[model samples]
Target chain A: MAISIVVTSGKGGVGKTTTTANLGTGLALQEKKVCLIDMDIGLRNLDVVLGLENRIIYDIIDVIEGRAKLHQALIKDKRFDDKLYLLPAAQHADKTAINGEQVKAIIDELRSDFDYILIDCPAGIESGFQNAIAGADEAIVVATPEISAVRDADRVIGLLEKAEMAPPKLVINRIRSKMMQDGEVLDIDEITTHLAIELLGIVVDDDTVIRSSNQGEPVILDPKNQAAQGYRNIVRRILGETVPLMTIHEEKKSFFAKLFGKKK
Target chain B: MSTKNVKLKGTKEGYTIVLHDVASFEEILIDLEELLLNISKQNNASTEISVHVDTENRLLSDEQLAKVYQLVEQHSTMKIGKVQTNVLTKEAATLWKESENVATLVTTVRNGQVVTMPGDVMLLGSIHQGGTLKAAGNIYLFGELKGIVHAGYLGDEDKVVFAKFNHDAQVRIGEQVQIIEGKGKNEPLEDTTFAYVNDLHILSFDQLDQIRAIKPKLGNQTGGLL
Candidate 1:
């Protein structure tokens, strides 16, 4: 049976889609069959982030409305060699087009084939959010190291707690190390403690994440990248592996030390 | 010739008309009417006497109480001041019991969650930022407070919030609110600290031991002398 997880952030622009895309691809790299379902509906971007936009002929709405079969709506990622697939959201229909029962039915149908089903939930606590979480066995709450994002994540976590699913894990995304060290922004400990949930992983703020997303490729495709390492660590943790959190300070120290040593 | 079913006594505030619980409603009404007429005639017509009606251990219906008021109004110099009863209805008893209690909760108050209490609250879990805990009376917190707490939510200014201060959270006592930004020139709040509305009507933070000097009623509840 597949473990379905919903990636959600109550506030917009906190990298829920990016986390979903990377984690889905990361699982595929581990030889696990994964399906990335974009629940953002009219504002779908998971297909674009995974570079499978041109390949999507049918979407989740089409399948939910009985216009297409479940297998026909799933867009296979060419890079994963049949290991990764995406059920894109309908760009034409609003979030109200689908309900919780329909999403649960679709997830139940895909359970036998996929090893993991990651639903990319939309922002806010609306019907779309409810539908996305209805079929999820677990949830990943994404939040940036900012007050507003953390506050919204806290609200989402509270909602998830009320749901029948297991306690949702937290992913602190877009962490700026310098700002955190200088106390300009909230630190990881502060955000985690305030949210009061188990911390899954932390992704460092890197411009390459944005560049790679614009290129229609998830940053996790680059194994050596710091942000990619963060996502990979989270994927390993999800697979029940005990991996130590990546040290951002250690990574920063080596690069500067090498340059200063060369100058001496 | 009729036995007295009602007696009028002088009190410091005014006169009190005590109705006999064992007497029939008709007998009490008849006796009360005759006694009020006599008192009205004895007093000068210019002076008005407002008397309290005390029904000892008697529960009167609304119509019965209204009848008593109507009888008192018949006399020109007499008027009803207040009505007193010793018995309570089930609903009123439940409400009264709730307002005198202190609820103890052990669960975490998460963001967007609001915990409201009829009286005081003693919470054992943390309140996350964006969460709120409010009470109609005082609040006694034993856990970490990172959210907003409103004590005396129904506007009873004497209520206080007793807890260790987290500098970032906000405290509200009645109409006064203090956002503890840790920026005030006053000494930093330590453990066993509390926030209350002071005599100046400003929200002030102080040590818990000083609660006796600030709100003596809170101390008087637990065998402390008034």
Candidate 2:
């Protein structure tokens, strides 16, 4: 049976698609048969992010509407030793064209063959959000340190709870530690307590995530990047492993602190 | 003259116009209007006279009541005194409920989202810089408060405003306003801060234990997490 999860954030542009792509890739790298299902529908970007845009002869809507076979629509990624498949959403369709029930039925059909199914939920509390969560048994809420992002994450958590899914885990994306110490933004402790949810992981603010996406690649493919390690830890945690979070400090001023006569 | 659908009676204060419950709405309205027209012709006096509208053992819909009011308004000599919904059943129950006096915030009040609520307002998360919160009653912030806040917005000077953290926010309660200037390094020396009127001054304090010890009046509190 597949462990189905939805990656969602109430506010747009907080790295929901990026996390979904990376975590899906991370799980596949560990020799798991992982499938990344893009539920954003008309606003689909997972294909471009995953560098699988050209391989799409069919899409999720085609498979669900019985225009294409499941095998015909699933695009295989050869980057991983195991396998990473993507079910790209249709670009020509509106979100309302598909409802929750149809999405649930599609996920059920793909569950038996894969070890994991990660859904990229669309932003907001509209029909698209409901459709993405319809078949998900678990959820990971991605939020930035921004107040607007956290607030939207809170609302999404409330909705996820009401939908009867297990308590969703939180992933704080784009953390800026230096800014946080200067009191310019909220830190991990403040955000976690205010959101009142179990933190899955934190991805430090890195240009690698954006550069990788533009190149049609996920940041997780680059093992040297700190944000890549963050994604790996998230996959380990989801697989029932205990991993300590990445240590984010106030820009490591201790080297200067001792010389400047500041008490250690 | 007495019409079949309209009954005009003389009250102690003035004339009373009663409409039949079983009559068609148009018939009742027309005859009642005609009765007012006749009364105006007979009196030939001032355009306004104090009168009562009696809906006999029936509940009139707003449309029917407005028509009756308009009928009296159209006449040159009748002014409305009282309109009665006597022997009514279930109309008042569903038509009204408790007043809306509470506002809830489960998410961040984003920049440019101005929230104005009556009675008490409770925020579960922080309000971003461009957003402003206005409440008629008290304001409680379970999370950070970085935006502008106006409590007792309906001019209730007794309402209190509280928050867990600050970001150089401006607060207004009643007639007094307080702006936390500079970098917000000096915030009441407490983990949780609260502001309210103390002797006509908008005083802020972080010492909740001392405030609880002093027992300042925190009035008309409303909403929080259930």
Candidate 3:
């Protein structure tokens, strides 16, 4: 039986799609058959993040609307042989084009075939949220250290509890440890306190996330990247391994190390 | 005139017996009967009194409305008309009211979400920055209130907005709005706080006992929306 998890954030631009993409890729690294479903119809980007945007022929809406079969619409990850696949969302279709029941049924069909199904949920607590959360065994709420993002995450946590999605885990993404130490933004503990949910993992602020995304590659594929280390730890933790959170040490450049640093 | 707080609205069909939401159905019925009796003694105007028992969230059952219709027939020479209601509001209202209470909010009100309630709201959780909670009655918060809250929505300035702890929350009581600035984590603003519309200004008190010491001054206690 596959464990379906929906990655959601009540607020927009809080790295929910990124978390979904990275976590799905991280799970596939464990040799698990993982399928990433982009549920953010009309605003789809998960396929692009996984570097499989050009391989898509049909979308989630097409599958639900009977235009295409589930397997026919699924795009296997360009990098992974048989470990990872992606069901891209329809850009032209509205969020309601696929109802919760339809999404749930589709997810149920995919359950027996995969080890993990990660649904990249759209922002806001609306029909899209309801649809994305349906049929998911668990939820992962992504948030940043900012007050606004944390506040929205708190609301999302409350909503997930209402939906009764197995006590949603929290992912504090894009956290600036320097800012937290300076008391400029909320720390990890403060965010957990505000949201009142179990801490799943924390992704420290890293520039490599954007660079990897521009190349249509998930940052988790980069072994040396701090954010990738964060995601790998999360994947281990999900596999019931007690992995410590990645320490966001200050990026110090020694005089000789900087002088002899490898050119990009 | 609404004699003894019994309101009669002139509808296109005839007159509607507007019931007070706060008062019991029986109390409203007695007041309506008294008003009809007084009207009959004054002049023989052929007026009808069809009860508008359709309320938001909770509507009177057919049997319950039948009792009112039969009671009005026995008390006065008024014909009952068909009752209509906003069923959507009634369903949404009753469902929330029944499942939870004024003090227990099942979910945190997020930004861009407007929570307009029928009665007093007791939010057991925090409110987001752009989130709003408007009610026809008072608002009591046991958690942080960092959002906008407008209490006394129906123009009852006597209503108050209270927080379990002090924070940078903007509260409105009818026309009066007050914001306690700075971090509520320390200093003069420490401890729980409550605010009410007193005179033309909004009065905020830090201690619960402080409410008893201050004599409320008169002010405009009507018409404010957020």
Candidate 4:
């Protein structure tokens, strides 16, 4: 069965689009045909983050409105021509132009052609959010370790439950293991306790993520970076492979290493 | 002129009608019959039309009423869907009166009580612990809602707000207005609050909630028996 996952967070700027781009790319790297959909209309950044901004001639709105065929709008990744594709959101239109049914129809068409369809949901719980989750078979709730992000994630969880899309998998992104060890930040256990969802994987704070994003390449593309390794582990877990979670101690070295001379 | 082909108009019991004035009722019936035959043949879908007439001066005998019924029956395409007197029950009349602008179920949070409303709600509490509260309508945090609060959930943006304290990390209504960093700290006023986007950015208490009440009401208005 094709797995459709929605990467959503109640709050904005908590690494939802970043995670979608990385995970989709990581899955494609694993030889699984993956398609990442950018549902954030008007302020679309997925194409930029994926380094396919200049290549998007058509977008999701065109496919839904029948202005363009589905195959015509799908931008194939130059890095992984046959394995990965991007369905960009419209830049000129707002979220109101599309609804849940139209999103479902688009995803249904994508199901038979790909192994994984990752929808990068808009931050707030509005029409754009609903449109992203309407056809999703599973959901990945991305959150940071801060109290505010966790609280927003909790609200999103409550909404998922009410929408009959409960118990979404959790990904605590940008976790600072050293901060948690030194009592400077909330730990994974504290967040899991409050969020009450199954843990998929935790992505530690790595400067490599920022650097890679600046370079217009996801960290997953860099196999040497610890954050890249973390994304790979997440992909393995999604593929049902029994990969052990990387120790927090290993992540601390990279943080200090980058602080000194190591190029992250 | 044949009276049978002339269309007729009259009151029958409680119903009224305007018929095609041809020559006689029989001629009118023949024209309607031909029209029905043409419609059924043109479209496979079932189509039907019916006419009834009653007059005290030219009271149609039982035989005449029977003739009209028989003429309608002869047109296979035309079938009478329903025939009923125009009378509404007192219960139905009252139902119509009660159906306008019913208040929505809202969960209200005030002082300490947390009441959920059927529509949307308002929050009136000091969310000191840095937790979060969300509602389907506009959220009005009367006290210092220092934690997080989400409004315009389920995609409703017309909902707005009022708040005395806005120290929360975020205040989101629909897709707009995410105050990640609390709006610093404003001097406590008798009644100060904030609303969602308008002609201006985030409307401050002095601008939007002009209802100079010090402590506003909060919590779900829906019945909370417990």
* Chain B, per-candidate TM-score: 0.84, 0.53, 0.48, 0.39
Candidate 2: CAPRI quality band: incorrect
How well does candidate 1 match the true structure in TM-score terms?
0.78
Candidate with best lDDT: 1
Q: For model 1, how does the per-residue alpha-carbon lDDT over A1-264 read when each residue is reduced to its tens digit?
A: 999999999999999999999999999999999998999999999998998899989999889889899999999998989999999999999999999999999999999999999999999998999999999999999999998998899889889988968999999999988888787898888888777789999999999999999999999999789999999999999999999987766334467678787542
Model 2 clash pairs are: A151-B108, B47-B76
RMSD of each: 5.1, 8.0, 10.3, 16.5
Clashes of each: 0, 2, 3, 31
Clashing pairs in 3: B57-B90, B57-B94, B102-B122
TM-score of each: 0.78, 0.61, 0.69, 0.55
Q: Which ten residues in a row have the lowest lDDT in candidate 4 chain A?
A: A249-258
TM-score of predicted chain A against the true chain A, for each candidate = 0.96, 0.94, 0.94, 0.93
Better of 2 and 4 by DockQ: 2
Tell me the lDDT of model 4 at A243: 87
Candidate lDDT scores, in order, read: 0.89, 0.83, 0.79, 0.71
Give the DockQ (2 decimals) of all models. 0.57, 0.05, 0.17, 0.03
Q: Mark the 10 consecutive residues where model 2 chain B has the least summed lDDT.
A: B92-101
How do the residues A151-252 of candidate 3 rate in per-residue lDDT, one tens digit apiece?
788777767876876989999999887887787888888778667678999998889999899899899988888889899999999999998777775767
